[model samples]
Target: MRTTLNIEDDVLAETKVWARRQGLSAVQVVFRLLRFVLSGGMEQAETGSAVVAGFRRFQETSPKLVTNEQIDQLRDQVGL
Candidate 1:
């Protein structure tokens, strides 16, 4: 499975750096990224979840427990 791609210079540079930091070769990194994208990983990222090391995906939640006024009041009471 040998092929050629025309990747942007900046994109390739960043991918190389990321691959080095993850202890993976550039080809491995590119392969995994392509697999992930083809397997709907981008949808998860768009929906506020991310895949982390060890193949774990976590959802981000924001519960509206307090309003801005409450936060401001608390900040003022804290003397700052």
Candidate 2:
């Protein structure tokens, strides 16, 4: 099927790069990525297209970075 769709430039570039490394064609990569997207395999609800790579939180090493003052302020504002 032939159709037109808009895609981000960086996505296409990364796909091409991955395809080259994996020895898969761009079409195959796109099909796989589309399936992943449609299947909701990515868990990051706020960032579409993240499902292809899965969600990864960068907070693992900085879990205690927030100050208690900020936490208390937000808690009071939210009536928590």
Candidate 3:
């Protein structure tokens, strides 16, 4: 199947960069992105929960680098 679509300049540029980084052609990158989007893999509501849960798990397992009090102190020092 073939069709014509107008992609934004910035999007085209970024897609080219992504293609080069991934060792794929611009067409391949667009195809993959379109497939992902068409399949609803990029649905924010569905994905956001999983991403939030993963972050929560990571936060629980990871060591904290700074405390809220420390952040507040730094912010005060910076007159923020």
Number of the top TM-score candidate:
1
Candidate structures ordered by TM-score, highest first: 1, 3, 2
Instruction: List candidate 3 segments past 4 Å from native.
Output: 44-46, 49-80
lDDT of 3 at 78: 100
Each candidate's lDDT (Cα)? 0.82, 0.77, 0.79
Ten residues in sequence with the least summed lDDT for candidate 1 = 51-60
Q: Which residue runs of candidate 2 sit more than 4 Å off their true CA positions? A: 44-80
Residue-level lDDT of model 1, residues 1-80, one tens digit each, is 77899999998999999999999998889999999888878867776565555254445476457889998999999987
**lDDT tens digits, residues 21-72, model 2?**
9999988999988887677665454443354455544434445678999999
| lDDT (Cα, 0-100) at 28 in candidate 3 | 98
Q: What TM-score number comes out for model 1?
A: 0.57
TM-score list, all predictions: 0.57, 0.48, 0.54
lDDT of 2: 0.77
Measured with C-alpha atoms, the lDDT of residue 26 in candidate 3 is: 98
Residue pairs with backbone overlap in model 3: none
